[model samples]
Structure formats: structure tokens, C-alpha cells
Target: MSIPQFDWEACINLMLQAMQGAQLGLLRLLSWLHLARDIDGQPAWPFALRLSGEVLLIDHNVVRALVSALGCLVAALLLLALAVAWRRRRWLLLGLAVALVLLAPWPDQALLTTAATPTSFHTSPERFSAAGIVRGEQLYRQQCIACHGADGRGNTPLGLSLEVAPPNLSSGLLWRRFDGDLYWSLRHGKGGMPAFEASTSPADRWALLDYLKANAAGVGVTDTGSWPRPVALPDMALDCRASTVTRLDQWQGQRIRLVIGGTAPLPSEDPRLQSVLLGGQASGAVGAIACASHEATALRAIAILTGVPEERLAGTELLADRDGWLRARNSSGQWSQQDMLCRSPLASGSPVAQVAQVGGSGLDQLIAAMDEEPVRFIKGGFVH
Candidate 1:
């Protein structure tokens, strides 16, 4: 058999488009399926991923089917548009509407096939930005949508048939690993993924990543698909009143250890962290604190504010996973668009009397941020 010409940039470009179409189709179907006459507010689209420990992990197949169907619809629409214009020698927007409504069911294989076989495929990654996301979408469909699935959920029949499930590029795991890992993976095709280093060019891989983005659902979800954009800050100043003392009431007696600050694996030399065992000495009631933030300068300030001993602070921040995750130590006082600054730990808190307020956020928005042996803190930046 004759070999088809292989162009890395072009194939990925087409794949991106196909994947994008799948995503759009999924969105449209979900939006349509959930549409209802609202008695008062917008219709509730019940497609949220549950975050309870007891809740079993499950797949949203309805959304997946919608994505697949939408991909077909997008193609069908293009064909209908072409057919209408071919006969009339003019644009026919009506075809788009008719194609959209055709997801009901169909024996019309020819018409459907016409839509499925997209004609305008771009190959060059550079051209993608210039030509537009439509080109990017095409590339995604060509190379990735087969394994990643239209929704980015790694649920396609082909992907599922593989021995190891393709990594959900949408998961936090991606952000945790450096981009080099992904590039290497794409080039090498770890495990079941066939290495395309010989075939898929560098430019195409980068472009595909750009279009793929970091999705939580691993299907065709986008950034906005999961988390709402931070509430647009008011143009003018703003104030938010929050309370850190609220959660502290629960951790009254728990000892807070000190985790130190370090840019690399070893965090010993980090100055801001000293040593103090809160309540360890029967006489002095103080605890250690974790200081990882740039400039442990804040730890000293915390020592003075909290009245914890300079010797009581230890230094080390421990977390099973910290990528794209957050941990809140103090969440009191009011903040505004103007005061969007992170809280000052050393600037406040009293340790001599031993009052602790600590909290953490999980890497996954779904997981509860863990509160382990509370990382103690003196007035100094943070001693572990």
C-alpha cells in the first residue's frame, strides 16, 4: 500500500480542530439537554463532579455522547452549508440551523458522512494562530482526540481499549510535572502511547498542548469548563471581611510543628526558621511553623506578633501534593481588590498563650485541604 504523506505540523493542526469541534458539540448538547423553561433563574445543568469521600467516582457518559454527536453535527452543518451554497451559488445560513436540529436520529448516512469528513484541514502550527482556533481544532482531531477523547476524559473506545488508560491530561498531574515531561512523553510515547518523536514534529506538539490546555475533567473541558474565573476584581477598590479565628476554634490543643523554607529539596539552611517546640517545655507554650514562601522575613514578624519563642520555630512545609494547590494559615480580617495581598503570618498571631488557626486547600478543588499535625509558628517568619 502507498504511504500517505506525513506532516507533523499539519496532522496535529487537523486533530486540534476535530477535538475542538467535539468539545463544542458536547457543550451544545449539554446546554440543550439541560435547557428548561425557567420559573425564575437559569436552568440547572446537573453535570457537576461530586467531591465527597464516600461518593463513588463515576463517568459522565451523557456528556461524552453529546460530545461525539456534536462532532458529527459540526461536520454535517459544514456540508449542508456547502450543499446549499453549491446549488444557490450563495451562502445558506439555514443549513446550519437544520444541521443542528438533526441530532434527533438519522438514516441519512450520506449527509452525515459529508459532515464527518471535514475538508479545510491546516498543517502548519504557526498558521494555526494566524488561521485561527478552527485550524487548531482540526489538528487536535487528527492526532489526539482518538486517545484523549473529545471531552479530554480518556474515554474513547480506542483509548479505553488500551491496557493503561491514557493519562488524563486534564488532571493536576500535568501541572505537577514540568512541561519537559509532557514533551518527552509525546516524543517517547510512554507505555501504550506510541512514540511519535519520529513523526509528530516539535512545533505540532507544542501547539497541541496549547490547544489542549489544563482541563480538570480530562475530556474536552477548558479552563472555564471547571473553575469559574476569579471574580473579576472591581475596577475600583474593594474590601472583603474574612475570619481566621473561625477555624482555629477547632484546633485549640493540637500541636503545630514547624516546616522550614527552602527553594530546593533540602531546606535546612533557611534562616527565617529557627527552633521552638510549642508547649514542649512544660513552662513555655509555643509551636513551630512552616516557612516556604520566598523571603522568610515574614517569620520573624510572626514570632513577635504571636509571642512564640524564637527557638520554637522549625522549618518545613509538607504536602502529599502541592501543585496548583493552596493552604491557608490565617484567613481573618477584611480584604479588597486593593488588599488582595496574602495574609501576614508573623505580623499577627499569639503563641505564648498558644492560640492556633490553620487551614489548607487541596490541589483538587474536589478534595478537602488536609490539616495535619498543625504546622506551628512563632512571630518569626516560620520555624520548623
Candidate 2:
């Protein structure tokens, strides 16, 4: 008798397909439950819903309520099934109970406790506007600089004298916390920290947060080569010739190339991006918008965001996405896409190369890459 040959390749292919399908289904389930975490261990909520023509962002609270409702519905169904089984027979009830015990979702106790803990319902009223950040910087210097230091590293002598040394505001820990939680801490004293509520107004507190976040972002990028959180480009008043636009935020829906300081004449502006010049003689020059008012404040804010000295920012170039999220920085007087600070989530987890090896100009490649894998931001934080 001849033995039939086993189709090993076909079996392997079938197994692979099944595994892939299972993985995709699990991911969908996690996303729906709002339990998915990105590479950065931050919540990866799929909040954007594309409607007929525009994209609508669902509120986080609404999404949470929906998930809770779904969970409650599932529990009710299970209870109904168990009740029906109990009425049928005592043995059936026992069997159903056992099945449920085995199949029920048993989450970690720690995670359950965390979920049960009440979070502050309040959110920052300040939208992190450039004006808010400038006010924040002033407040920070006046109130926080004593303990937190000018750089926010909490390296000052007063910080060391505390029972619990002040935390480094420039660290990623600041981004990990909710803005409301931070607000509460500022309004009411936390361990070793004094209450600011007596001295600063509510608006001032929010502005302080903006400055800390902006400072932390710059320090983070300098230390780690990427933003710790999704940072909005600090909005500032702009002076544009032959254009009605008056502020940086008005350029939303278009990419911005911000040139801080360079001796060279501004390069021909790419149609894909709007060029904004700062700290140069080309104020009224062609192909770029210039900052006429608030130049000093704008320059200082940019310095905080880049972790570069005010003087050194002259030759720096920053790239902001269409959504106004700062994405990259190039210190070299020349433009190079390889200097991207916030890499695409789709990119291989490899360090950015020092030299450009891809085809076409660096700017073109960067724009294409950005469009292909746009940054995903959730609740003021970044999801890698």
C-alpha cells in the first residue's frame, strides 16, 4: 500500500492564515474595549470616525461610557443564561456556573483597582496657546524656578532641602500624569510642594502647565531624540505680507517650515509647506512669513521647545505637521529629513540615520513619509 504524501506546506499556510485572523480579531476587540496600549504604554484609543466627508473625533468620556455599557450588557446576558439554566435543572445550574467561572474575564486586581479609582473630571481650559505658554514661562520663573530651577531639572539647592526632593519637571514623568491631576496638585499641596492656589489664579495654573510641558518637550527631545508627548506648535502672532493670516495657528491644515536663524537667503518655499522666518534680515523677503510682534517671546519659547540656547537657534529649522504638531528639527543650516525627531509609528524601530540615503530630496521624502504614516495623538499624549 502506497502512503499518501502529507501536504505540510498547505497545512502551514492554513495555520498562518488562522493565526493572522485571530490576531486581527483580538486587536479589534482590545480597541473596542479601550484596553489597547501602544509601544509607549499609552492608551491607543481609536477615536476618529470618518463620516460622509469630515472626520469626527469621539469624546473619551463617550467612548468610556459605551465600553461600560457593552460590558454591562454582556454581564446581563450571562446572568440571564445562568438563570435560565438554574430553572431547567440543579445539575444544569452547576454546569453553567462552572463554564462561566472558566470562561469569564478575570482582569488583574491592580488594574481593576486603578479603574475603580476616581479621576478628576476637569480638563485644562487653556488650549496651550502661545500666549498661555508665554504667561506660563513668566509664572514659572517667578514661582517655580526657585525649587525646579530654570531648566526644570529640580537641581536647585532648595529642591535638595525638601523632605522629598522635587521631581525633575523636564523628565517624562510630567507627561505621564493627567493635566487635571497636576492641577489638583498645584492647587492643593502635594508632598513637599507648597500650594500655588493662594498666589496664582486658575488661569495662571493652567499656563504654568503649558510652560512645563513645553520645557519638558524640549528637554525630552534633546535627551532622547524624540518628543515625550505630542506637542502642539506654540501659537504666536505672525506678520505676513500679501496674506490675511495673522497667527501661527491659522496655518493649520498646512505644513510649516519655521526657520529660526540663518545667514542664507530663504530657500524657495515648497508648495507643500509654508516658510516662516524668525531672527533674520529677510523680514519682508519673498516666500516666507515673518514674526513682527512678540519676536522675543516667540524666540524664547522656541528655545525652550528645542532645548537650544536663544543664540544658537539662529540656524535651526523646525517642521510642524498639517495638524500643528511639531515633528522634526534640523540644526544644520541645510534642510534634511533625516533629522526627524518624532519618527513614524510604521518605521522600523531603528535609530535615524546620520546621512540621507533615500531617493529624491530629503524634504520630498519626509513629506511623503509623513502623509503615509501621520502621527497619532490621543488626549495630549503621543502613541508610538
> Which candidate ranks first by lDDT, i.e. highest?
2
TM-scores for the candidates: 0.26, 0.67
* Model 2, span 1-384: residue lDDT tens: 999775433333343344335534655586568666542122332323101100012133333343354465566567667777677675665565566555555321311112111122235654667677778999988888999998789999999899899988887666555465577678777889889878988888888888888988888888888886678788777777777877777777899888875665555566788787776553553444433334557888888888888888776788888877788787765556656777544243233342234567777666665665466543312122
**Candidate 1 on 1-384: residue-level lDDT in tens?**
999654432332343344445634554565577642221122221233211111011222332343456677777677667777677633455556565667634322311111211111112223212112223345667877898876566888989999998877655444333233455566567878887777766676655544444123213112322121111000111111231221211222332222332222332222311212221222322222221122222343233222233354343221211111112221122211221111112222332112122322221211122222122221001111
lDDT of 1 at 11: 32
Q: Report lDDT (CA) for all predictions.
A: 0.34, 0.64
Model 1: runs farther than 4 Å from truth? 1-136, 214-384
lDDT of 2 at 120: 26
Measured on C-alpha atoms, candidate 2 has an lDDT of 0.64
Clashes of 2: 1
Q: What residue runs in model 2 are displaced by over 4 Å at the alpha carbon?
A: 1-103, 112-121, 280-295, 344-358, 377-384
10 residues in a row with least lDDT, candidate 2: 49-58
Give the Å error, residue 259, model 1.
44
